[model samples]
Target: MENFKIDVDADGIALITFDVPGRSMNTLTSGVMAEIPQVVERIKTDDAIKGAVLTSGKASGFCAGADLGDMAGGMLAGGSLQEAYDAGWKLNGALRALETCGKPVAAAINGLALGGGLELTLACHYRVVGDSAKIQLGLPEIKVGLFPGGGGTQRLTRLIGVQAAMTAMTAGSSWRPNDAKGAGVVHEVVAAGTEVEAAKAWIKGGGKAVQPWDDKGFKQPGGGPYHPVGIQNFLVGNAMIRKQTYGNYPAATNLMKAVYEGIQVPMDAALRIETRYFIKTLMTPQAQAMIRSLFLSKQELDKGAVRPAGIPQSDPKKVTVIGAGMMGAGIAYVQALAGIETILIDRSQEDADKGKAHVEALLKKRLSRGQLTQEKYDALLASVTATTDYDLIKGSDLVIEAVFENREIKADVTKRAEAQLEGGAVFGSNTSTLPITGLAEASVRPEDFIGIHFFSPVDKMMLVEIILGEKTGEAAIAKSLDYVMKIKKTPIVVNDGRGFYTSRCFGTYVAEGLAMLEEGYAPALIDNLGRATGMPRGPLEMHDDVALDLSVKIAK
Candidate 1:
């Protein structure tokens, strides 16, 4: 039942360790919060204690901020807005109390000090971090469409300069120990596995519990001289954020406002403003929808709701791809690279040979980039066996038809591949538009048919949408899930429908951009705006690269 422990040594140096029994990482949950006051009281009452160091028992650094699972549960239970507000207020108060404690405190940051974890460190008088690559520090609540509800906004701005904090908060970029130290976030960087010792040394060395900003009536360095420069930073940063997010995200902008406003006031006033903004941003429909789509829905889909529970998994060692076109070759290359024996079959030897060559070129590029060794490349190339023979697919655990978009052509390939494979072998179609149920009509065993839709340039795209038709059995879905995981790609399962969720939602972004262009908006402006919104590519540029023809094809 122990959530935290304070061990006071004879010399009056206390170590406040957060173990949080039954959890691998410490998260600021209600139970954990409830225990903090008692621990604080103990430290306050102990006359012998001169100073303390806070550290985590888990390898994952401090806490991972507030527990989203707990937050979602409370919100779902129809909790009042005031209740949520009070919860956040109480957590902030606890952190502030620690900061103002009579005894000095040091944070031993071992791993990731993120969100609430980083806020805790900011509250400490000094921080010493381990040089672990896994140790990332940041307040990335913006990724989930929320600001740091804790005192992260005010504390981060005070620790670093305003502009640096603005960039980090809005971009939601985590930093390594070196970078954190350079940004003035962490006071010292110690070697990995030695953070606790370093923290203890600092505390025993009589390090004062005074932050720089508090000690010297600190004015933000480079504020006036750099105020004009902030205009450019804000403009370019806004543009970049918009381009990446497609204006679909609001958290970035809200975070920008928080950093911008918080830096203008003293720490106390800044903290109040930050908390108010955090609550306001959290209640926005965009934030709630993002939380639902990016967190809740994504979690459910990743857990294999589309896969059947009782079906045994499929280890697809051998896969047959029945097309030599762009999509087909991409699939073949990915399969071969994953060490799966792949057969790239086409209507002619030349066609199949071209697909083989495409894979070779990709692997050679990887070798040249030092991403693959020559021996690995050779082995990967050897995994792909190309031919014009349909009979070569007989032993394949799965067959993916990647031929032309015509229904009859796809149906023919489906039937031909199904005839060659065993009854249990799954049949998949790499169709972007066709309904899975309709494609299943061509299969002898309709229950074995499903859609394994790969985005273009399959080797690069992280998402593989698995579509389950009405007649597709548990075994087919299960096998598909297993295969997708084996290839080291994220699987998002959706019920069979035209232009599944990503494609459907993505089309809206491109279409809107085009609509703006058609209304005499400059293509550059539209593109810049899209990039500023946080999309990887500008809409018009991506449209041209993907070809307007394909968008039309998918639309149909």
Candidate 2:
């Protein structure tokens, strides 16, 4: 009741709004989960209520899915498989009961709906959504090493084709509003405010409560896993999973199993089978670690949990990035995109211009893919002032040097930029090696000196390691964290060290590949085996990605 508010209109349509108290976004917390069944029961028993419309009160999105801070509480951590199964099955039962409650239930999805949120929409007999590209809808639980247990595997496959469902769920893909409707998952797409009206209108216009799977002689799309066409797809799908996951991720394989098996049965029985696989997937230690790191820990870091509370959040009005190569150019691109005036400097006018050119190249790729409007692309491109003028640092609140991994070059850029920089402004060295404390020696404001390490292909990489020099004050740290957050990259604060945090961790991984090479193994074999372990790239390939020159500098 606290998480949901229900109002029955004069036309006998119950509007159920999911609004979790004291939260900016709605999540399936224990209170909200508990109320789902209660609401379904109310819809079933109340004679005056002809149907219901479900929606979220939060503007940021519908539900962000399970509150993993709760570790999904009973669904994964109850000390036994039976306990986890029982807990998950309860919600599945509630969702199933609602769809079969003998009255049409329509979901008025206003914004993002992921994982259980998407599953909730699927359980409804009809779904009407607002037309917004920002509004994403999909089941993305596979990212945190868990598969959907809320009838997602069963229902989505039955609703769409099995092959499409497998691809979406396994990739943890999300889609825009129109894409959802095109995929046959959503019934209607309307203007933003009219989504709720459309949902209510559907039920009033005689929408049926019965699901496709529950209908007599209903057939699943693309047939079951054993059909002639389905058999080839599953055969190919199993091979794809092995290649993609390298047999390391069980959740991906089990999800395929759940869909494969559940697609053949009735809705109720399929829900039970999905729950069983969900429990089996949850029992893995890999899932536990992934949930903690990829979900819980990532959520905390992404929200700036380590940022200094005493200091007010402030993003730099202007940021200067030196070096126009991949890292520097990428940093400037993101900063400019975040609406921060960016100055990209290098040794020459030609070098600085190349940085802006790189931004243009990336923008063009996005434009060709229809990810950016040409006007927006031009505006972003114009925001970066690519030049050789160190004088431009005069008004920059933050100056990041992303040159090579040489101390002298780093020190030179630091001192040159510092001469033009105003008082108390932060200086960030984007070096993976060379301690920040040592680099701070060139700065008049050592307290304002910090390391802002960015990975290669900076636009794609999410992590930004903020290395604290011995004299780096909270203001510099806070400033760096704020800027990182503003740019929408994950930031992790670490004390100064040679090859701090990420580099240190990656060094160990790359070391094994080198060891194999030293043991007379072929470089290609080392890389192939390394990649099979689910690394983004093979060890040698990663070294090349970070640049062989930078790798050598780090080693030295």
Candidate 3:
């Protein structure tokens, strides 16, 4: 009752507003979860409530799903198998009861509805969403090292065929409000403010009070998993999963199992199967580490935990990127997309122009796909200036050197950039292995020098390793943290050293691979087994992706 406020209209329609106190976004915490079954029971017993409409009181979104902080170990903080099962089944059971409570319920989703948020809508007999592309809806639990435990795999697969549901869930992909209708995830897409009324209208106007699965003769779309078509889907799906994840991500594999098997049974039994797999997944070492890193550590770092104290955050509006090769181009692209003015310089005008062309190619693809509007595309394109002129970088608040892994060239560029940089401007080297202190030797302002090592294909990679040199100042650290936040990348700060943290850690993997190779193991075999152990890629593949024998040399 504290989390959910219910108002019954004259027509016996109960409008349940989900507004968790002291939270900008509504997430299913233990308190919220505890209230769920109570709400379901009220809906089932109250004669005044003919139907229910669920909406969020907060403007941020409907719900963000289970609070990852609570979910870190809370779901299976266990005593026995039965206790774990009960813990996982809490939401699943509440949702199941709501769906079969003999009264209609429609979810009025206004903004982002992810993971259990989307799962909540799936349980509703009818769902209406706001007509805005900004409203994202999907099961993104897998991204945070968890699978959707609240009847997601079963209900979503049942609602929108197995292929579409399973594919999006596994990919941690979200759908816009416009696409949700076509995908059958939502019943209506009304104007933003009308979503709640729309849901109530659906219920009061005698919308089917029964869920598709709860009704008689509910044949799953595209047939069950054992059907000839579904059989092929499983065969191909399993092969594709193995090829991609290699049994490393138990959350992904378990989700696949939960969906593949859940589709064959009745709803209640299917939910139990999903819960079992979810609990099993939570117990895995990979999932535990992923939860710690992706949720806890990533959250802390994203909040600037690694940043130096007592310095005000300074997000650079204009940044200078030296070297218009792939790495530099990628950095420029992300900067421009974030509405920052970027000067992308190269040795040749042609290469500088090629860097600009890279941004054009990417934007045009988005524009053609309707993801980017013409106005926004033009604005983003105008944000970057690609040229060979070093003079163009004079007013930049920050400069990042992204040239090759050579010392002399880097030092030369550092001096050239330093000549034009104003006092307080931070200098960053995009080197993977060179120590920040060593790179700072070329700088006139060592305290202002740092290393902002971006991963290859910077636009796609979310991580930016910030290296603090021996003389790196608090202002420089603070500046780098804010700048990475502006571009929406995660940052982890480390002291200057050879290979830094990531590259050094990566070298160990390659060292093992190299030792195995010397022992007469094949590259493909080692790589495959490496991937099977949950690596994003094999050591060789990782080195290849970095455009380097970099890890190999680092390992040596």
Candidate 4:
């Protein structure tokens, strides 16, 4: 009752709203899970309550998912493996009880429902989603090196087909309301403010207490795992999973095992099968490490934990990008998409126009996919100005130089852009290899200069490494972090070094592969081995993509 606000209407319809105290978003913590059974009992015991509607009181989303910090900590706590295994079963038992409690329950998903959040809804007899593109629903536990422990593997596969369920859980892809409804994850999609009412109406209209899977003579959606169709799917799916993961991710393999083995049994037995493998996955070190870095650490960094305290946040209204190359063009496009006035500069109008054309090409692709409206695309195009004039950069809050990676050329461009900027404006260099401190020597205000290293083909890569120069002030670093956050990209702060962070580690990987070639290792064998180890591309292929001719010139 503490985590949930319950009220029974005159019609005996109980609405339980989830709103975790002391947190901005709702997450299924140990306290929340303990409260769930009590709430379910309240709905069952109260004769006035005929049916129940579960929803969230938060504006942000329904729930962010299970509290990973609590779950991961308990799984890795100083206890026997049996202790951890027992902890996972508590939630599974509660969800199973809720599903079979003999009362019709409807889930009114107002916003994002992920992992345990989505799993809880699967127990409900009916689900209604709010019509918002920003609303995301999925079981993204795989990203944190965990599988769904709350009967998700069994229920999702039963609700949707095995192939669809496998893709959703493994890839951690979130779906919009319409997409989720079409995929059979939700029963209906309504306007943003009407999801709760829609769910209540379903309950009020006497929705079935019994789930389809719980009915007698029920069958799996795509046939059990041994059927001709299922056999082909499992064989092909298992091979593809192994190839994609290269056997490094124990979670993926175990997930496949759970799905294949569980589908052959009754609902109760299937849930037990999933729980066994889910516990097995929890015992692995991969889950602990991934939860620490990807979930816990990522949450801290995204909150600007590294940014200097007491410095006010900076929102750049007008930004300038110096260069018309691939990196610069991508930067301009993203900036414009964020609704910032972007000035893209090059040596001549022809070159600057080419950069603008790049933005147009990307915009048209989005438009064709219905991700963007033509009107919005035109507005974004109009926000970007392609020019050869550095004078136009005046009054800009931030100017990023994505020019050639030559010290002299970067220095020259830095000086030109700095001269045009107003006082106290921050400047960044999108250099992957060069140190930010060395590049700062070219600026009049070295304190305002910082490194904002973006990956190649910038629009697709989510990470943006922010390097703090030796002389870089807190203001510059703070503003750069703000800019990266504005673009909705993950930022990692590091001290200035040659190829700071990602690039340095990446260079070391390619260097080892090149050494193998010199030692007479077959190129094909080395490439195959690299990919077998789950590297996205072979080291040799990656180097060539970075331009081998450029590497030769750098060596000279």
Candidate 5:
């Protein structure tokens, strides 16, 4: 009751708003699960209530899914696997009861409805989502080494086709409202403020109380896994899983099993099947480690848990990128995409214009794909000024040097760029190898010098490693984190060192492979083992990706 508020209108529509007090987002905890059955009972018994609508009071999203703290607590409490399995049933049971309570229910999803949140919407007979581009809906539990336990594996497959469902859940893919609707996960996507009314409208329009799979003579979208079409999907899907996961993720394998096995049975039994697989995954050490690193630690870092609280949050209005090569061009494009005025500077107008052309090419591709409006593309392109002028960086709040990775060149650009930066402006070196403290030696304001290492194909890569020099101040770290967030990239803070974090660790993989070759291992065997181990690329392919010549130089 504390987490949920119920109100019944004269039209016999009960609106149950999920608003976890003192929390910015709602999550399915044991307390929330325990409360759901009581609401289900109320909906079923109350003669005046004909149907119900479920929604969130939080502005940020509907729900973030399961409370990780509570989940990890249950799993790590020195309990038996059966105990963990039993605990999962408590949640699975509540969602099941809600679905089959003989009363219609509709979900009014205003924003993100991920993992258990998406599962909750699936349990409803109808779903109405706000037409907000930011709304993220997915069963992303697989990312944390667990599959959906609360009927997600069963219900999603039954709602959408099996192949589509498997792909979405396995990939931890999130979708916008329209995409969710297209996937048959949602019934309607209305204007932003009208989601709640739309849900009420669906229920008032005779929304069914039973799922299609539960109704008499109902058939699954693509028959059961044994059907010819189903066979092809599952066979290829199994091969795909082995190739993609390289059998590294137990959750992915079990999730496919749950969907494959569950769809052949009745709804109730399918839910039980999913819970069994879910608990199997929950008990693995891989799940625990992933939950900590990928979920808990990442969440803490994303919220700026280590940022100095004394320093005000940074909002970088303008940015400057030195050098017009691929890295520098990417930095400028992302800055412009974030609505920041960006200066893309190089040695000549032609070189800088090439960098601008890269941005234009990317914008054109996006426009062709309907990901960007022509007007928006023009504005973003206009925000970036490509030139050779150094004085133009005078107003930049952040100047990131993405020139060649030579110490002398970097030091030279550092002095020239820093001279143009305004008072309080932060300077960053985007070098993957050279130490930030060493780079800071050339800067007049060493306190403002920081390393902001971005990966290749910067627009696609999500991680941005922020290396703090010995002289780097908290304000510099804070501002760099802000700029990384502005570009929608994940930031991991580390001390200044050669190849800071990702690069330092990644280099070892190739080195180890090359070492194996020295030990008389066949080159083909080494590359095959690397790919089969779920690495992004084979050892040789990765070596080629970093460029063989560069790889040899780095190895030395």
Candidate 6:
């Protein structure tokens, strides 16, 4: 039941090891917090312990930080904003206590130190790191629409220079140990598995446990030259934040404000400012919704929440794709890259050759970037077979009809593919708006009919909406899920309907933009509004990229 244990050596140095039970990576939770005070008290009371070194027992990670699931659970249970603030404040208090204790405390970072994990190390007097490439350290709360609720804002500014901390915190950039040491957050970088030993040695050598900010009259390093002039930093930083965040996210601004406000005050007052901002940010509805959607919903979806409860996993190693347009070509390339045997069929040899050439061009680009070796490119290219014959689909485990959106054309391809393939093989339509049930009308076995609606340029987009028609069997859904996962794409399952989810939601964005234009709003203003709303691309820009003709066609 113990999450931590302390052992004191003959030299009066204590090594406090954190090994949370039944977990692969250490995380800060209320349970972990409750135990930490006891360890801190031991170090405080024992006169024999002159210094301490903290390290994790886990090899996978140093710590992943606070459990977002636990936070979401509490929020769903109607926990008040004050309660969350108090919870965070308690952890901050523990970190501060560890910092101010008479004995020195050194942190040995062995792997990822994120959120509360990074905050823990920042509180220590010194830090050493292992040479693992996966050993990254950062406060990434902004990605989920929140700032670091702990003392991350205050400590990071005081440790690294303010400009560096501001960029790191606002961007949520994780750094390697060597980069961290260069930024002054870490003291030394050692070989893998030697971080703890290096930290122990430092503490034993009487390294000062007090942080630079703890010393009176400590001016920040490189103050005059690098500091932004006369609120220029605030203006430029806020503008960039607005551009990137589209004002949909409030965390970035709040974090920037915290670091700016805190850097002007002493450490204690700075921490209070950080806590206030943290509490205020947590109360925002956008933060709550983002945490729920991005964390909890994503977790559930990843665990196959949309799949039928009793359905087992199935891998469709061989797939046949009809047509040689952008969608078909992209799907074929992704499938081949995943090592799946893909049969790409077109109406003519010229079209099939064009599709195969597209795959080769993509592989060549990857090779230029060093993302693919010549050998890998050869192997991936070998996985794809191009043809103009329907008979070539006989061995396909699944056949995706990606031809023109004409219902009769799709129906014809579906009938032909079914006749050529096995009885149990699933038929998927890559149509954006067509109902899977309507498409199933062409199939003799509707249970084998499903919709694998991939967005344009499928290899780049992460979302793949799998539409389950009324007659689609559990095995069909399972196979679709397996295929999407195998190709390293996230699948969102939706009931059979026109434009299922993303497409339907996207229509609203375009409609709003067009409505604004009709109401005498300038195109520039509409574009700005879209950017402010956090759309990756403005509606007008997206309309141009997708072409106005295509939008008209989809609407029809």
Model 1 TM-score, 2 decimals: 0.77
lDDT of 4 by residue, 151-265 (tens): 8888889889898999888898888889999999999999998987999899878799888889987788887667888677689899989888888889999999998998888
Candidates, ranked, TM-score: 4, 2, 5, 3, 6, 1
TM-score of model 5 relative to the true fold? 0.92
Query: Model 3 — TM-score against the truth?
Result: 0.91
TM-score for all predictions? Answer: 0.77, 0.94, 0.91, 0.94, 0.92, 0.84
Clashes of each: 22, 0, 0, 0, 0, 0
Stretches of candidate 6 off by over 4 Å are 5-17, 46-51, 72-84, 132-135, 176-185, 204-206, 221-231, 242-248, 315-397, 401-409, 456-460, 485-488
Q: Please report, in order, the local distance difference test score of every candidate based on alpha carbons.
A: 0.80, 0.89, 0.88, 0.88, 0.88, 0.84
Off by over 4 Å in 4: 361-379
Error of 3 at 253 (Å): 3.9
The clash tally of candidate 4 reads 0
Which scores higher on TM-score, 1 or 4? 4
Q: Which candidate is the best by TM-score?
A: 4
**How do the residues 64-91 of candidate 2 rate in per-residue lDDT, one tens digit apiece?**
8888667465676667778888987887
lDDT of 1 by residue, 1-556 (tens): 3888888887788888988788778888778777777777777788988888889988766888777767645533446777656665666777777777777889998778888888888888899998765678998888788888778877776666556777788777888888889988888998888887898898888888766656656766546224876455566767776655666676777776777677777666667677667766777888888788877766565656566677776688999999988888999988887889999999999999999999999998888755687898899999998899998998899998888777899988887888789878999988877889988888889898989999878889868888889898878888999888778777877887777777677777888999999999999899888877767788899899878888776666
Model 2 clash tally? 0
Q: lDDT tens string, model 6, 1-556?
A: 3899799998888888888899888998667877877888888899999889999889888889888777545433446766766665677778888888878999988889999998988888998988766688999998888988778988887776666777898888988877888888888999988887899899878889788888987876535224655255566777888778877788888988887788788777778788878867877898888888887787677767787777767878899999988889999999998889999999998999899889888988888755677898899998888899998898788999899878889999988999997877889999888888998999999998999988878879878889989899988999888888888887898998777888788777888888888999999989988987788877877788877987877767
lDDT of 2 at 40: 94
Per-prediction CA RMSD (Å): 5.3, 2.3, 2.7, 2.1, 2.5, 4.0
Point out the worst 10-residue segment of candidate 6 by lDDT: 222-231
